[model samples]
Target: MYRTSAMKQYQTVNIQAQTSGASPHRLIQMLMEGGLSRLAQARGAMERGQIALKGELIGKAIGIVGGLRDGLDLEKGGELATNLDGLYEYMVNRLMQANLKNDAAALDEVSDLLRTVKSGWDGISQ
Candidate 1:
């Protein structure tokens, strides 16, 4: 399960699970209501390799629907596993960068991505 805590600067959200699991569709709905456009912009950056983790370029971004429904264990679809991993890492990097830069806009982009993924998971559950 994911938990959220209020912080002085920003809210701290943590996903706790033995393995990474897919999110629910309602997450997508929430994202659409929040800022889907920003998510698209961030996605563009990802495609352009603008987003990096540990200074390494992200090569791909996978959008597999409910791929991780079983658990954190990865179930590859096509050739997207590696790219999805990179994208996930890149988002983590973006989150850190946004926090350090005090960029609310950047953080919003990441939030939207999370919501989309969660929504995909929700679809899987159904």
Candidate 2:
């Protein structure tokens, strides 16, 4: 139980650091990271036959993607925001499929896509 407690503490601290005074870009990056982490967890759960855990993780991923889509500012963002909105939708659909079919490939695809988006977002420092 010591390890679990330590992990919980670490997560709490990490979340505090991520949210405290975070910019909008930083928040989006965090969301992408969260979704990627969930996708990874879901894939592992699928491999281990943990159907409920897999479903939960995939659901969390879908929610994160949806949040990212909804957070886009179409007016100020222009074409880029529109493209991202479409991409986020695709990611959510793929995540749903991954959850239903236990498809690791689908999970990997979404993970890769999120990583690419995060990489681009990370490059915008300020």
Candidate 3:
């Protein structure tokens, strides 16, 4: 348990360090990736019947999706940003549903959406 805690702490610091030096574009990409990862973990927790863990993971994922939505500069980004904001909002709603019902399908749906968005984010030449 101590070893696991130590490893988690190390990873947290590493991610923090990476974020500290990252550009805004990279930060968005990181958030998308984190959301996807959390969704996957939430699914695993559901499968294991770890209800609380699943809820916690899904909540974290929803927060990440919210962050993505909040980061959108709708004023300057125009139609595309508006569309993405809507999509992110949808993702957050679905995440909440997944948490409430322990629904793996909902998790899959959000994972797919996030992946599509992240793919587009990745394609942009930053």
TM-score of each: 0.40, 0.84, 0.85
Clashes of each: 4, 0, 0
Q: How well is each residue in 14-102 modelled by candidate 2, as lDDT tens digits? A: 47657697766666777778878988999999999999999988887877777677678999999999999899889888888888888
TM-score of 2: 0.84
Per-residue alpha-carbon lDDT of candidate 3 for residues 1-126, written as tens digits (9 for 90 to 100) = 323432443355347748688766777777777878888999999999999999878877777777677667999999999999899878877877888877899999999989998998999997
lDDT-superior candidate, 1 or 2: 2
Query: Regarding TM-score, does 2 or 3 come out ahead?
Result: 3
State how far residue 13 of model 3 sits from its true place (Å): 10
- Compared with the true structure, what per-residue lDDT tens digits does model 1 show for residues 1-126? 111111110111113211234244443333233333444554456445564431221111112112221123346443455554555555656655653454556556666676766566456644
Cα miss at 6, model 3 (Å)?
26
| Model 1: worst 10 consecutive residues (lDDT sum) | 5-14
Q: Which stretches of candidate 3 lie over 4 Å from their true place?
A: 1-20
Order by lDDT, highest first: 2, 3, 1
